[model samples]
Target: MSEFVRLDPHVIDEIVAICDTTLDELRSARRITDFLAIGHNFGDFESSKQLAAGYARKGAGTPESARERVEQFIEALTQLRDAFASGGEAFLDAQFDWTRQLQNIDIDA
Candidate 1:
């Protein structure tokens, strides 16, 4: 026999709220990456230009860059928030169904 583990709806709400707050913070922080771009020809020397180009490429030049990674994290957090909210609703519905079922039972019979 399998036992059902009950989830507290309030806790779920708290988790969702935390996710929302974290997502907001991450989104704000992601803006900082916008300034990571460096000019390809940052100096008169060839080495300086190479260094700047490398930094810019790793920072925000391509689709698979540092900024993209931060965006991925934000996307993951958004999904987590949505999942928690959905789970909370499902838990509430299940609780209501269980209560209705118990109320319908005639213990004396």
Candidate 2:
């Protein structure tokens, strides 16, 4: 026999929104990191090519490991939200800052 757990539909929606927002933050972080790494103001062809290559070389994170971590976090949050019937969604929202988190990161360090 197999065991199954059920989650609230609304919680599922919140989870999806959180995942989407998190992915967007990750992408913005990557763009900012790539720009900082390149450190060029000009839009010349060579500079553009170098910037693209730099991004490829300095990937945001290793694909498999990054994916696993993201999935784990989402799963954990899903469980917590399901367990906390009161103010769970609000708590999740409070923890995630779609834009402010990116601005707060200190890439220069």
Candidate 3:
């Protein structure tokens, strides 16, 4: 698990931008890992791995390594957002169940 350090909103936005970037854009002649450092200490490694596996199963253009790091980045950013939205304890309490809730939500309604 990562330390409980609350990042600034601007920093979160920057991290999210990295996650939203495509693999090619992320690499830009460098390694994808370079842009993913912000998420390395955000914890939830298992969830990140699972999300990466899903991305791999989809046969996206990105390589597994890139996808894994990107997934971790995205998930970590999401967790941070949740923590910011609610209190930290509330976010932690519901963290593991969040995906299920999101999947079941009726966004079109």
Candidate 4:
């Protein structure tokens, strides 16, 4: 087998940090999508409380703060939806930003 390449501990730590940050951003985006989907599903219900309760029951976490969770969920979904809906131009813009961040990490690494 070929010998493994080794990196310094500090360098490894930095690289791991960069990866962690990127993954966090990705997960945030996915959570937003989930919340938005849930909101959409609740649209046809006639009662707000009942709908909220349903969401609370089905969601991964208990709605300790119902209003806040709903608001955060809706907000995240809106941001993701808006970003994608801005067409190819916006898509490129978002990619450019993420790429720039990645580039910086590479430079640092």
Which candidate order results from sorting by TM-score in descending order?
1, 2, 4, 3
Each candidate's lDDT (Cα)?
0.65, 0.49, 0.49, 0.47
Say which prediction, candidate 2 or candidate 4, comes out ahead on TM-score: 2
lDDT of 2 by residue, 45-99 (tens): 8978788555544543443233333444444444444434443444444334423
lDDT of 4 by residue, 13-101 (tens): 56555645554665666466356226555656569657755665545454333343444444443443344444323444454554454
Report the candidate with higher TM-score, 3 versus 4: 4
Cα error of candidate 2 at position 65, Å: 13
Best by TM-score: 1
Would you estimate the TM-scores of all the predictions? Answer: 0.61, 0.36, 0.27, 0.34
Q: Which clashing pairs does model 2 show?
A: none
Indicate the TM-score of model 4: 0.34
Clashing pairs in 1: none
Q: State candidate 2's TM-score.
A: 0.36
Candidate with better lDDT, 1 vs 2: 1
Q: Mark the 10 consecutive residues where model 1 has the least summed lDDT.
A: 100-109
In Å, residue 66's CA in model 2 sits off its true spot by 12
